[model samples]
Target: MRQDRAIRTRNLILESMASLFNEVGYDAATIAALVERTGLTRGALYFHFASKEDMARAVLDEAVTREGLSPQAFKLQEWVDLGLLLAHRLPREPILRAAIRLAVDPKARRLFGTRWPDWVALGRELLTEAKESGELLAHAEPAAVSRAFVGAWTGVQLVTEDLEEKLNLSEEIAGLYELLLPSIATPAVLAKLDLAPYRAERLLRKSCGQETPEHE
Candidate 1:
């Protein structure tokens, strides 16, 4: 119906704005430029969004919603789902990472600035779930553990991001999977992690030798 078109048009506008946001920082983005990029006149733009700030808010909500999808609506489950989702789609959608950086802008404080707290909450939830399943270190503090894991993963992605093009992602993950796999799990559960993600593992396998301490 008419409402559907409005939502769809809003989404189109948000998507155009996100593309621009990724290229330039959020403060630098402008309504006129957005209009030019989206091929929508000022009137059409206003019809869908009250103002440029409104459009930015809409874009943040859309990005968060997309990243926050956890299959079911449970908040904790959403955190874990976020992990899998990031793992599966990150190579293809580097913009998601860029979007997270933009979340911290003061002017857009409502959107990205509070994500660190969200990350803290996410860390607590995920570790709590893992503990309930009897899968964590016996004395692990959920907050500390969660923060460590999320921080490490986030930092690693930042560090290794450039490696994706120069190196093969799947093969690399497979190799790392073969190593980190054991630390996080028992032999039984660890067996289930796909080693295709760890690049070193594939290379070691090709060499037909046991994994060394470094890559392992």
Candidate 2:
């Protein structure tokens, strides 16, 4: 029980710090602000994180993995699932939003570095598998395509967030897939792909055993 409580407290601190960092850039998000946001004393906050940099690093660490994705018959489908899950989750998850902000900030990025390499590595791995399984076109290069995809995904999110009309990120990312897949994937595999914006939410629900009815 003590371990569980300690884990919960640590998570609370990280989540609160993430929100603070997202609202205010890394340089502006102070220890006092985090303490106020989490309703915890300085000592309590210090117990979980030695400094603000420490908290920021913790949040960035969580940004590397695809948390809600599952294996699919086509490795390219897994890759799409990963991107869609992030698109669906990033708007609602402060940790992810904060990580992206920190990664793109010149000062913060210099001090802590970004998770772009890690994401690129994961993408390359999946795309390589897809190519080996004949899902990709004969001339497609996994390394190059993966790097480009990461760049495109980041650009889409940043632009969508800045839009005056408040566009849906999931839809934008799905459209990105539609635009890019033809160049990377074979025609048959491309035709089999599900690029719907709502697919991420439905896949996540199905994974959790709370699958929504099709009629809904």
Candidate 3:
């Protein structure tokens, strides 16, 4: 199973690189550090990734891989779940943390671009679906709303990370939705939304084949 071994090696390199980048920004994630952390030879590392920039790009490519938010009857709820899930997992998921760090770092951004557009596109798609399903306010424009929401969500994450206890990110994000949703969502749909911090935990369990009760 050469393919399986190769996949495992690649994943190992990516995980080690993510941890290194999360701890110290992209510039500081030298090959030596990656090799030491992964306990793999420099040749093995180079076989998977030509350089640190290459590894950073690979991490950025998979920035949204862990986003497996289950489908919801309300598309807007899916959008909210996506943000909450990321908020819940970002601190624990080194790959996502590293990707965000690289995206925000001016130096690293020059080498590997940010995934803001991809996230914005995803939001726009969900919001468009929600709007078509009559879940949003009559005047809510999907493109504009999604763009603004993505920007606001990014700001919330940055501010939360700066706090003494960065673990409260999910709460901060839930509060953000509470403040913003009233303006974008219809009264009926608004009442149905779940903005609780624990929402992400439940969503994660549901994703892992656990039975999660549907929220109203």
Q: Number of clashes in every candidate structure?
A: 13, 0, 0
Ranking by TM-score: 2, 3, 1
Better of 1 and 2 by lDDT: 2
Residue range 133-167, candidate 2, lDDT tens digits: 99999999999999999999999999999989979
- Candidate 1 structure quality by residue, lDDT tens digits, 47-147: 87897677666654534323324233233333444454455455655345445546646656654453556666766876577666655546656787566
What stretches of model 3 exceed 4 Å from their correct place?
Answer: 1-5, 165-167, 210-216
Model 1 quality (TM-score): 0.66
lDDT of 1 at 113: 55
What do the candidate models score in CA lDDT, each in turn? Answer: 0.56, 0.90, 0.86
lDDT of 3 by residue, 15-100 (tens): 88898887887777788887778889988888888888888888898776435587888999999998998889887778888888
Worst 10 residues of 2 by lDDT: 207-216
The order by descending lDDT is 2, 3, 1
How far out, in Å, is residue 216 in model 1?
Answer: 38
